[model samples]
Target chain A: MIEAIRECLGQEMDADSRVVVIGEDVGVLGGVFRATDGLQARFGKERVVDMPLAEGVIVGSGIGLAMSGLRPVIELQFLGFGHQAFHQIGQQVARLRYRSQGRHALPLVIRSPFGGGVRTPELHSDAFEAFYTHTPGLKVVAPATAYDAKGLLAAAMESDDPVLYLEPLKGYRLTKDEVPDERYTVPLGKLRVARAGTAVTLIAWSAAVNVAERAAEELSEQGISVEVLDLRSLNPLDIDGIAESVSKTGRVAILHEAPLTGGFGGELVATIQQECFYSLEAPIIRISAPDTPYPLGGVEDLYIPDVDRVVDEVAALAKASA
Target chain B: MSESRFLPNFESIAPFSRLTESGILDSGESPMSDEAVLEALRYMTLTRVFDDKATSMQRQGRFGTFSSVRGQEASVVGAASALDPAKDWIVPQYREFPALIRHGYPIENFALYFMGNPKGGTIPANVNMLPMQISLAAQIPQATGLAWGLKMQGSDGVAITFFGDGASSEGDFHESLNLAGIVKAPVIFFLQNNGWAISTPRENQTAARSFAERAIGYGVEGVIVDGNDLLAVHEVTARAVAKARAGDGPTLIESVTYRTGAHNTADDPTRYIDQQELEKWQQKDPVERIKNYLRSRGIWNETLEQEMLDSCAAQIDEAMEIARNTPLATSDALFDHVYAEPPQRMLDQKLDWANRNGGAR
Candidate 1:
């Protein structure tokens, strides 16, 4: 996924001179994750800038750049660090176009990696997509596959509105697939059905999709057929797509790495029930982490919902409905 | 260990000025032409009239809550008058109607904005200015980015942003200055030290002697000017704009002034204000000082003052009438401008809202 992102950024910058990348260590350092590797050398220091270690300025200045006819892609080192810049991202970037009444178009992308798997420090693996998804003007997208990462990033850069592109930290190097050499865009606000079944449906996004796919395979071996839906876009949620799947399966389990209370899973549950109320044969289950801060590395595996948890929860829902 | 010994020695920055409180030309010859002075006087007078009308309208339930730019008219108008609207951009805070008016934003838009219309923020394409930022110091880095973007596009236009003393404490201010200094961005940080941030005084806002001195830490040129003196504010701003256009990097100009009125219609200055200080600042009223200077030059008289007052009053009355007659934004308008293309969910929600409200799609 990292290599795919780097390639997509190179292609976008090559196609548009107005496309600029600004962040901390995005220039000579090639970014902490190397997602912007060799960009500064190929595009020069002017296009790929290394901003100071200030998150507020990074996004705030990007707003100004976008206003001046430049498409700015901001690379936040981690999603946790974005709290320092929520004022810029939520208040300014998301509201500029709406506040200006279409006078100013802020075509900018704020990219960040999140979710726990690797033994990162505290606050490094936090998943806070719910906050951005709640913002009205922003389009929140979390790509669960390499092909989707590149394609969705291309689509995000081309978008006239602000996009929050969240890359799963666990999938950056672990998630792999065959990506086309030429450029291709995956349209946002759509869900991809990773697996097909009939008895139960598993709704997930980002790194949670991997867990759902694995759980589906295990469930199939047990004769409890499962359907896995990878929600690529969270804000402009594919409600119609979700409703179609839920009506087909009649049983559902929403999963995420965020805390249980007030997580995006709650919103999904509410939406699903409203859309698929008569079709639902069993109650929708939410498989999520506890409502606690992201703990230290040693016990994080216990904190994140694994495949067993998804399999167990879905199997119970399937049996109860049957 | 003595903490005093560890403290670094710093040179004190003196406030730059060209006009005295009595409107005397103190610093050699004036850089302003006779026509320019009259124009500045006219805008300053108009700002005062607008402020007074807005406050009155708010009290009479004819307008929404508004911030009064009563005593700091010279600081807002003088700095804005220095820009070439064709190329330069103005990024202003909320209390800058005078500057926005000088920069070609229609006076009626101000009425519409305070009346809670989103169309009020819709600046004309020809006007190189951002909408009024209500958030403190949030526009500083954006202004720097604008200047940086201009430089990258090979345009020589400079970007100037207005902020208050309270905003000087925000992290965006420090980060923007540090970034603009290193990149040599063509921008100006116009800090209006208007003595109070609601109830907090300037002394409590910062422990440093002057806000301008902090510029040294960022490796940028910093200067202070008597914000009440229109000549001083204009000279300093023009010089900074020239330097920025010449690729010399950003400058931080701290314009020292006072907000003699309440912070806004919701505020009552009588609660926390000192009578002695208010009386002293009233003596240095910017509009009165400029009028005195114009009168001393035989360029202003009773007839000219009456004409300016009548013209300003008529303009305000017409703008308010138009604002009152302008139709309120429809429910569908809320769903627009969020994105280039509305999503299916949004379209569905819009349809649902229209169905419930019995309105057209």
Candidate 2:
């Protein structure tokens, strides 16, 4: 996924002179994750510039660059670190176009990696997509696969509105898939059906998609065919796709690594009930981490919802509906 | 009690000034031409007139809550006049109607903004200015970025951002200055030390002797100007703009001024401000000081003042009429401009909203 992201960035920078990459350690250092490796050398220091450690300035300055006819792709290092820049991301970046009544086209992308199971430090693996998804005028996308990562990033850079492109931290090196060499975009606000089934549906995104796919395989052995839907975008949610899947299966389990209270899962559950109320044969179950801060590495496995948790919940939903 | 070793001795920096409080030239000849000074006086008068009318309209329920540019006209107009609207850009805080007007923003648009119309926020394509940023110090880094972009485009234009003494305390201010200093962005950090941020005084805002001195820590040139003296403000800003355009990097200009009026229409200055202090600031009113200077030079008189007042009132009336007659945006307008292409869910929600509100408008 990291190489794919770097390739897509190079392709875009090659295509557009206005596409500038700015972040802490993005220039000579090639970024902490090497997602921007060789960009500064190829594109020159002016295009791929290293920024100060301040997160607020990174995103805030990007807003100005975008306003001045430059497509700025800012890296926030980690999603947890974005809290320092929430004012810029949420208040200024999200509302600039709306507040300006569309006169200002902020063609900007804020990329960050998040989610647990990588044994990272505290605040390094939190899934805080809900904070951005709740902000109006922002398109929130979380790509679960390497192909989607490159495609979604391309689409985000091409977008006139600001986009929050969240990459799953664990999937950066672990997840692998065949991504096309040539440039292509996976349109945002759509869900990818990772697996097909009939008895039950599993809704997930980012790293959770891996867990959902694995759980589907386990459920299939027990004769409970499971459908796994990977929501690529969160803000402009794939509501139509979700409704279609829920109506087909009649049983659903929404999963995420974020805490239970006020997590994006609650929004998905509400949306499902609203759109597929009559089709639902059983109550929608929400599988999530507890309503506590992301703990240290020792208990992170217990904190994150694993394949066992998803499989158990899907099997219960299938049996209850049957 | 002994002084802590951490406390270091600092030198007191004097604010740059060209005119006395009595409107007499205190330094060398003014840098402004007679024609330019007259133009500045006209814009300052117009700003005062517009501000008064907007405040009155707000009280009469005709306009939205407004922040008046009452005593900060010289600081606002002086710095704004230094920019070339064709190339330079102004990223303004809320209290910059005078500057926006000087930069060629229409009076009708300003009136529309005070009337709570979103269209007012949209600047014409030709005008190189961002919308008024209500968030404190948020536009500082944006100004730096805009300046950097201009430099990258090989343009000689500079970007100037405005903020208050209160905003000087925000993290964005420090972060933006540090970044601009490192990159040598062609930008100007215009800080208006207006003595108060609502109820908090300038003393509470910072322990430093002057906000300008903070620039030394960022490796950026810093200057302090007597904001009430239009000549000093204009001279200091012009020098900074020239330096920025010449690729000498960013400059932090701390314009020392005061906000003699309420912070906004909803605020009551009587609550926290001392009457004696307000009275003293009133003596150094920027509008009166400029008017006095113009009169001393035989460029201004009672007849000229009446004509200016009449012209300003006529313009204000016309703009207010246009703003009053402008139709409000429809329900679907809310769904528009969020993205280049509205998502299916947004479209559905818009349809639902229209249906709920008795069909489309």
Candidate 3:
């Protein structure tokens, strides 16, 4: 995924000189996530700038740069630190296109590591995609593997809207797969299925995709058929894929780490119930974080929906059908 | 022509002064256009009447709690009128009724906001203004960014942002100023120093003598002006806005005004502030000073003043009726604009909620 992001940056800068990058340690240290590693040496500091340790300044400047006919890709060092610049992201960048009567384009992308399981300290492991998704005129995407990361990064850069490109820290280096080095763009709303199954559909995105696949394997051993669907995009969600999967399986389980009350899970469950109301053998279930602030330390695992939770739901569904 | 006949260069005027309290434009300044002076007074009166009526409605439970721009109308209207309306943009904090109204926002829009509708107060897409923001200092960087966008579009338009004295304490304000200066973006930071932010006094807000001085550190010119003097405020703002539109970079304007009312109907200034301060400011009310000046110029009369008051009251009454008659926002709009194409999740939630709540069926 890191290599894919770097490759996209290289391709985008090569195509458009107006595409510049700015973030902390992005130039010399190659970013704390290594997504911009070596872009500074290749694109030069003028293009791949290393800004101060101020999130507000970084995002505020991106707005200025984007307004100046330049496409600036910004990296927030961590998803938690983005709280510092929520005003710029939520109030300014998100509304610039609509507020200006489509005369202005905030052609900017904010990329950062999000979600838990890396054992980072307080504020470092946050699932903030839901927050960005809640905002208008902003696109939020979380790629679980290399292909979506690279394709989505290219897609985000070429677009004229602001995008929150969330890189799941747990899936960043641990899960690597083949990705085309050439320039290829993935449409914002398209979803890709990581693995296919027939009995019950397992819907997930970002780090949850990995857990879904693991649950699919465990459910297969228990003579339970499970289909794993990876939701590559969040904001412009691939509803077609969701409907198609639910139509075949007749059962759905939505998964996410954010608290369940206003989580994307509720929305997904609602969508399945609406689209395939007659096809259901059981009510659609959601395996999500309990409605609480994400707990830390020994309780972090409990805060996130895992493979065991996914398997348990699958078992109950399979038994009900039998 | 005597030296007094020449327009007084705002560059020489004291930032906060009371020369205009006697109800006369100094004879030294160039004779101003009679029409321009009347227009300024007209808008100022309208703003004052509108504020009073809106508050009364809130008290009567006709509208929700509202932020009143009572004493600071002259500063807001003067500065807004000074700009080229077609080319400039406005980013307003909650308490900018005078500026918003002058820029073509109807009083019904305030009703829309108070009625809990997002689309209610939404500035028309074609208008050069943004919706009023309630979050402290959140709109500063946005104005800076919008101005920068305007510069990139090759238009020499400037964007002005309004905030209260308390908002100056937010980090976004400082960050926005630094970026605007560094990029030389055409934007103006208009700070209304209205003495108190709810219960907190100006002395406790910041140690910096004047908020405008902070711009100096950002490599831009900063000025302090008596916000109550409509002519002085207009002249100072006109010059600063011209400089910005000409690509001379941003300016920080500190308008030293007094809030004659509570921050809103929700607040009670009598609790923390001295009653003496309120009485003292009544001696220098912005609208009364302008009216006194116009009467002295022989352009205004007792009969004309009474007629204008009656007309202003009638206009407010009409606006109140329109605001009250406006329909409440429907719940469907909440799901409608979240995205150009909402995800299935949104559609599902809308359907589920609708089916259960009876909106879907």
Number of the predicted model whose lDDT against the real structure is largest: 1
lDDT of 2 by residue, A223-285 (tens): 999999999999788888998999999999999999999999999999898999999999999
Off by over 4 Å in 3: A6-52, A57-73, A87-108, A116-122, A130-139, A154-162, A170-190, A198-203, A207-226, A236-322, B1-18, B24-32, B115-119, B295-298, B303-325, B345-361
Query: What does the lDDT read for residue A56 in candidate 3?
Result: 88
Q: How close is candidate 2 to the true structure, as a TM-score?
A: 0.97
Task: State the displacement of the C-alpha of residue A34, model 1, in Å, after optimal TM-score superposition.
Answer: 0.9
* Model 3 docking grade: acceptable
Candidate number with greatest DockQ: 1
Model 2, C-alpha of B278: deviation from truth (Å): 1.4
- DockQ computed for model 1 against the true two-chain complex using alpha carbons: 0.79
Ten residues in sequence with the least summed lDDT for candidate 1 chain B:
B1-10
> Backbone collision count in every prediction?
0, 0, 3
Q: Summarize candidate 1's per-residue lDDT along B81-118 as a digit string, tens digits.
A: 89998999999899988788888888888889898877
Tens digit of per-residue lDDT, candidate 1, span A160-198: 989999999999999999899899899999999999989
TM-score of model 3 (first chain only): 0.96
Q: List the candidates' TM-scores in order.
A: 0.98, 0.97, 0.80
Q: Looking at candidate 2, what is the lDDT of residue B76? A: 91
- Cα lDDT of model 2 by residue, B258-283, tens digit: 99899999999899999998999999
Worst 10 residues of 2 chain B by lDDT: B1-10
Lowest lDDT block of 10, candidate 3 chain B: B5-14
